[model samples]
Target: MTSQASLSVTAETQENTLTEVFSLQKSAFQITPYPSLTERKHTLQLLHRLLVNHQQNIIDAINNDFGLRSSDESRIAEIIPSLQAIHYTLKRLPRWMKPKRRHVSWQLQPASCKILYQPLGVAGIMVPWNYPLFLAVSPLVAALSAGNRAMVKMSEYTPHTAELFKQLITDNFPEDLISVITGNADIAIQFSQLPFDHLLFTGSTQTGKKVMQAAANNLTPVTLELGGKSPTIIAPDYPINEAAKRICFGKSLNAGQTCVAPDYILLPENQLNLFIDAFTAHFQQMYPDFAHNSSYSHIINDRQFQRLQQGLVDAQQKGAKIINVSDFAPDATTRRFPIHLVTHTNESMLICQEEIFGPILPLITYSTIEQAISFVNQQPRPLALYLFSHEQDLHDKVLVNTHSGGVCLNETLLHVAVDDLPFGGVGPSGMGHYHGQEGFQTFSQAKSILKKGRINSTQFIYPPYKNKAINWLYKLLLR
Candidate 1:
């Protein structure tokens, strides 16, 4: 057989397998749709143990996928957060499982209204290549906590991590309970087309649209955790040195391959040069000799590395000054693209036009705070917005006027670490939230139910609307 035909046959076989697994999970969910709180907690415990036991393996897999993924970064950004999420969910699962008592109107006396959080059968999670483990496990934690079976689709770009994760899951869990899917883009398309009860996807906005479209055919509700040009603003009052240090840490972590990483900076015009100098010093201190530093991370692959390099070139050709903060050259073999600050960027530049998912930060200066806010408003809503300021009025103004998935005042990227705060985006950035309680609720269906005794008070108005008692009651109620 020809190579193309063989590949086609393989995809067809995988699709058939996926369909069989989906049916098995669906049938299993029907048998035990709502798992008890203890059962859910036990499942979470198993996941927690798996992550803790295989920490080194997980880190090594991610490192192999990326040319050089920092071990500490993987633990800090992926393993630690996943473990924390599971821990937090386990502690709160009992309370979240309780049916919420809702208010019943006076006219409906002797009746109780409550919302039951029921599992939504099968949930589909599409994991992104960057931060593969956390993105996959975080949502799975929520899904299992809500008592739902899940089928996760791991990114093909991170083949090593995907294969290891699939193996670990297959060894530990039942196929009908939690199965991991690994394949190329064709498999991803087939995976998304599955008739899931609820689907959650995390990736670029463009790909998010495709996922949503496929889910729509099944009438499936979707929670899209998409990426956009997340912006950071350094206020005039905040210390430039401190702001630079925090921004450096956020952007340099994972080599700026984060969905919530600060994409560009909006600073006061007069402080641009000072901020640039401070950012350079802080970044250098954070990762000295970053090109050869094992502490630093590399781009996930050459495609992403080349895209970032070309973005810098395009910015320079369009009259933007490219400032290499680390003063290190790009290493093609290692795929380590040094951090470059693009100044005097215009709308025509690729750096300004798209989400730079690499170590490329574009700096846009404004004359006043209002101008800064305006500039942000002009762009589509982002997944995250950061402002470094001590002024209460400034914080309130930015919060009131701007729209973003989440905001971190005087900080960057740390908000996601908080277990209580719900994380999601608005408009173009993405839709729906999945974090603490919000996550459980997103995966579960809120079934509204009303309970009453044998007494049928509603019968009074059921028939013969012309009755005097009914008229009086209507008048009284209306008044």
Candidate 2:
């Protein structure tokens, strides 16, 4: 029989390590309590420096993890936005930290009221494999800005990137101030179970449910950035070529591994062929030869690739047409899977039911804008909804009728890049906003404080049978 004693020891050791780290972070946070504005700015500046100085290393690690993550994609999607977020937060942190005064009612004479943004002690972040850098540090940036210590649990699927991130973070800051934890699913569960002040998780909806359950044991507030089938609708009036170009650009970037990437496109019934032609032309122009193109990214790992392959097979077997954009066969060895357009899909097909995280785009045709809107409403509210329309009335109508985390009018995948806008999801997609001012607010506690000096006004209403002053005061207040 195996040694149960050894197993027990191993389990105890892991538990000790997790507790030690949590305790250390908690103690460190108590020591400082609230970090000054200068300290917060310095932390942000250091993070900015870390990203800038190690840009090449980050690109290389992500490429090694993905086999061929586009360097430009990493720079544009990861580095630029991170730096921009830091800068934007730094510029606005002062105002965000300032207390706002409130009006005092006549009933509460000589009292002053204000709201203070205070730091929540410690935070825990669970990062997903896709877009590892941005997802991990974006929340970390917010936590640090709000003057809280954080511990990040990186995804195991991207080992190379996670290990490199661990090294970079360790070298940059103290473990108690900010630490990176790397392990398998068991560790993720334990990490989520920790009684942090707040927990933010970025991953799939199923995993998010488990994490939320674990957090519930501690009553820890959670911010879930989960994934859903984000739909893109091309209005009839919009030019098919422009729509196709932007859609293909958004979909093909990072092999459509992005959380907010267009999952399925709602096409106009009459211009389906023209839209396909234009989409193909734009993809070809962007990468004339995908099999040999280094600019395009591969699926992160074999398991994800197989899931995508199985989903495609399921779609094809259900009489859905699959249009492979490239001429090359998908080789498991290379892992550079090409984009496929699926049409004639029903809810029975796996592609329509689940989130297609890979480079699979299903084109659902609609007869009218109302049909498109209805189709979207029928499903769970998505993280993002893209509408390519020039008509002002249509935009107004669609905006009013639909509910999503965010909307992009005549664009795709670029709204998240805007630092001023709040980025998050709704319903099954996600909960909680984290970007710009919203992000700072997410990690901070808005403590309402009221002040009164030498005023015993409440004494007038003290325990008495029927005091004349109390009756007059009550009548005056009521009046």
Clashes of each: 0, 0
- What is the C-alpha lDDT profile of model 2 across 1-479, one tens digit per residue? 36988876766787678889999999999999999999999989999999999999999999999998999999989888888999999999999999989999977778999999899998999999989999888899899999999999999998998999999999999989898999888788878989999999999999999999999999999999997999999999999999999999999999999988999999899988898888888888898777889899999999999999999999999999998888866779978888898889999999999999989999999999999999999999999999999999999999999999999999988999988898899999999989888889999999999898897786777887399988888777777
The candidate that wins on TM-score is 1
lDDT of all predictions, in order shown? 0.93, 0.91
**Which 10-residue window in model 2 sums to the lowest lDDT?**
7-16
Q: Model 2 RMSD to the real structure? A: 1.6
> What is the TM-score of each predicted model, taking all chains together?
0.99, 0.97
List where candidate 2 sits over 4 angstroms from the true fold: 1-11, 468-479
TM-score result, candidate 2? 0.97
